[model samples]
Target: MSSDLPALILGVLCGTGGTIGYVKTGSVPSLVAGLGVGALYTYSSQRIRNNLPYGIELALLASTVLAGSSVPRAIKTGKPLPQVLSVLAASGLIYYGVKFMQRE
Candidate 1:
């Protein structure tokens, strides 16, 4: 599976969010999840050379979790942007992940 630009960007977004969460909450779990999840999504690209096994699928799972989590907040806040972007990213990731699995 070729790691593409979109996934990388999403990973950065996740990592940045995690960093921010860490700064705000001072929680070890938040720190780990953010960086871990970010790397799972972002570092699977060309730079990693021998990327993590099942990286795309793992990234897809992460994006799905993001989408699932954002939906409730969007609904409660009546803000559609977060939900829309998360859903779109998850859908795209799912598509690529499926294609990668099929190719394998």
Candidate 2:
């Protein structure tokens, strides 16, 4: 599988989660963050796939945003969704961070 596949999947999941949150609770913030971060992840995936610049950086940024937002919520609420998101986003951070460092 391609390395960017994970980021693409993460983007789709984030978008879907955001949409679901909006539909269920009318959370405009959730919708906006979801779609916005999803778009950023998607763009980063494309850049990585094409070997373009800043792909890893962008992915790292998106992951950091996701982790930053979700970790506190997970700690505060003990909710499964935030916990899962925190784990996924953290994984993305580690993965992309390593990729970024490995680049000469």
Candidate 3:
């Protein structure tokens, strides 16, 4: 298998695992939201590294905050927004951080 395949599989597994875990614990909404946010973060990081004219880091932070804040809400009210936001933010951070580190 290719190296990228591992990363991709890991990502999917993480998301699936989180969802299953949350559902089992009756926190499905939160899991959904967090996953959404995480995906967003990942995408944003790529954009930033691509040299898009935007503050990728800030966007990532914002998404993170949004998602993180949503988790509690999901747990209490079964809402998924918080989780989604959190995931997106995390993805953004990861993307940019990786790109920045790779810069020559």
Candidate 4:
């Protein structure tokens, strides 16, 4: 599969998760972080699709942030959502990280 596919999926999941969090708990932070990172992932995915610059870098950054935040939450809360997000983010990190390295 293309590297962009994972980013796209992550973007959708993040957006959906964020929306759900806001609707269920009225958490503005969740909404903002989710939508913000989701947009980044989406834009990066588009960039990657178009063969533009920094696509992998942007995805890597977003994935790093997501992993950093979600991993701890997953560990602390042991919730399914956080755990899932953590896994996806970590996967994105590994995927984009490898792609980024390969480009050099």
Candidate 4 residue spans exceeding 4 A from truth = none
Candidate 2 least-lDDT 10 residues: 95-104
lDDT of 2 at 84: 96
- Model 2: C-alpha RMSD to truth? 0.9
Listed in order, each prediction's TM-score against the native is 0.58, 0.96, 0.40, 0.94
Judged by whole-model lDDT over C-alpha atoms, candidate 4 comes out at: 0.93
Backbone atom clashes (below 3 Å) for every candidate: 0, 0, 17, 0
Mind giving the per-residue lDDT tens digits that candidate 1 earns over 5-79? 666777787778778778998877656766776776676543333654665665676676666666676778877
Task: Write the residue-wise lDDT of candidate 4 on 1-104 in tens digits.
Answer: 99788889989989988999999999999999999999999999999999999999999989998998899999999999889999899899989989988999
TM-score of candidate 2 on Cα atoms, chains taken together: 0.96
Better of 2 and 4 by TM-score: 2
What's the ranking of the predictions by TM-score, best on top?
Answer: 2, 4, 1, 3
lDDT of each: 0.66, 0.92, 0.51, 0.93
For all predictions, the C-alpha RMSD in Å is: 4.0, 0.9, 7.6, 0.9
Clashing pairs in 1: none
For candidate 4, the C-alpha RMSD (Å) to the true structure equals 0.9
